[model samples]
Target: MINISEIANEKIKEMLAAEETPNLFLRIGVKEGGCSGFSYGMGFDDEQHEDDKVIEYSGLKVVVDSDSLKYLNGLEIDFKESAMGGGFTINNPNASATCGCGSSFRTATEAGNPAADPC
Candidate 1:
């Protein structure tokens, strides 16, 4: 399971509303790539697969596929606005190592590639 901070909830609602889709769900997952071996993937989705897990936070709907659930469990998502810009940050307790870019990460037991460099 994951937790969305109030700031993230507000920003996500605004983005979803702009999409103009009445039933859009925020889909988050991990895919192979990046320096850390795994990268985060997030976007608006309209359909949920059979193995997807759905959670309702505030008024936003979130969907995470089973394969990514283990990696994302206990994650806390927050939105922050700084002089530079506004962005979403993920605090993933499950990640043993994360890349400098922040979006890429790896757990001790599940590194994505045999040849991927250590984080």
Candidate 2:
């Protein structure tokens, strides 16, 4: 399970209001290609695959695939707004190392293995 802040809830609500249709959920996953080994991905989703792990939060649904969930079991999704504007941020306790951009990260045992990357 992951933690969601009230700020995050507000951001998601804004996104939900902007959509033309309802039933859109946020999909969080990890992929590759950074100085570190893995990168986090987030998108508005309207579909759920067979292997997805679905969790509901504040009338919103968060979905994660089985493989991606393994690496993000207890992560938190945060909404941050600063001089850089606003965006969804990730707080991953399992990460031992992260790149300067804060997009890619690596665990203690993995180095440069880029999550879900074909390369």
Candidate 3:
């Protein structure tokens, strides 16, 4: 299961409210090609696929594709604010190793496709 922290939830709600597009929901997924072999993808999407797995948190809809569900199970999302700026943070339990930027990771059994360029 995926978990969204209270702070992240509030931040996501605010962002969603600011969007001009209607019916936008959060979409999270894993993609190949990163410094660590796999990268994470997260954004607002209006489209849904047949193989999507949907979960709701306090009225906010979160969707994950079947292919990425295995890599994102037990994932934790949070938001942190600093003097410079604020951003969302991800904690993935399924990742065996993560890159320095924390946006890329590799699982114990899978290495995906790593990019030659650094993140």
Candidate 4:
């Protein structure tokens, strides 16, 4: 299961409300190639695939593809405020190691494909 913290939920809702496009839902996924071999993808999407798993949180809809479900299971999302600014943060239980930027990770059983570029 995926968890979205209260702060993150509120921030997401605000962003959704500000969007010009309608019927947008949050989409989260894992993709190959990063400093740690795997990278995360999150954005607003209006399209839904046959293999998508939809999860609802306080009237918010989130979609996850079948291929990324395994890597994102038990994932936790949160947002924090700072003097500079605030951004969403991820706490992934499936990740054995994460890159310095915290945008890439590697699981205990899988290393995925690391990119040549630096994080």
Candidate 5:
């Protein structure tokens, strides 16, 4: 299952409030690209597919597709504020290797094709 920290929950709620759509749901998935072959993707979605898995945390809605769930299951998302700024951080137990920027990762079982050279 995917988990969101208290800090992230608050941040997500704030973000959703700023959106034009009142019923926006946080969607998390993985796509083929980045240095590590797979990159995490998150955005506000108002639509859901038949195979989507939906859950709620701190009253916020989250959805993940079946395919992406394999890579995102047991994922923990947190929010952090520092001198640079504020950002969301993902701690994924299923990732065998992650890129320098921490947005891309590869699993032990499959390393999908990268869009370009490693960054």
Candidate 6:
């Protein structure tokens, strides 16, 4: 299960309020081709595909596809507000390496595996 901090909930709420769709979720996934060979993908999704493991926290829906769930399960998500500005950050114990930009990551076992970005 993934945990979401209060800050993360607030940020998600703000995003949800701005969306016109009634059904939405914070969708997380992985893609290839960051400096680290794989990168994290995060965004708002309104649809849930078959085989997605959906979790709810603070009235917000969070979805992880079956494939990405292995790499993202047990993650702790929070909203960070520092001099660098504000954004949602994922503390993933599964990540073996992170890119220089800090936005990309790859797991030890899955490193170098090519998974194209859907976006």
TM-score to native of every candidate shown: 0.91, 0.84, 0.92, 0.92, 0.91, 0.84
Kindly give the stretch of ten consecutive residues in candidate 6 with the minimal lDDT sum: 110-119
Model 2 — TM-score against the truth? 0.84
**After superposition, candidate 5 runs with Cα above 4 Å error:** 111-119
The stretch of ten residues in a row with the least summed lDDT in candidate 5 is 110-119
Evaluate model 3: give its lDDT: 0.91
Worst 10 residues of 4 by lDDT: 110-119
Best candidate, TM-score:
4
**Candidate 6 wrong stretches, greater than 4 Å:** 110-119
| C-alpha RMSD of candidate 6 | 3.9
List the global CA lDDT of all models.
Answer: 0.88, 0.80, 0.91, 0.91, 0.89, 0.79
TM-score of 5: 0.91
**Pairs in clash, predicted candidate 5:** none
Give the per-residue lDDT of model 1 (tens digit) for 49-105: 999999999879999999999889899999989999989999999888888879888
Position 19, candidate 5: lDDT: 87
| Model 4 lDDT, residue 68, Cα | 100
lDDT at residue 119 of model 1 (Cα atoms): 54
> Which residue runs of candidate 1 sit more than 4 Å off their true CA positions?
110-114
What tens digits encode model 5's per-residue C-alpha lDDT throughout 59-108? Answer: 99999999998899899999999999999999999988888899998887
Better of 2 and 3 by lDDT: 3
lDDT ranking of the models: 4, 3, 5, 1, 2, 6
Q: List the residue pairs that clash in candidate 4.
A: none
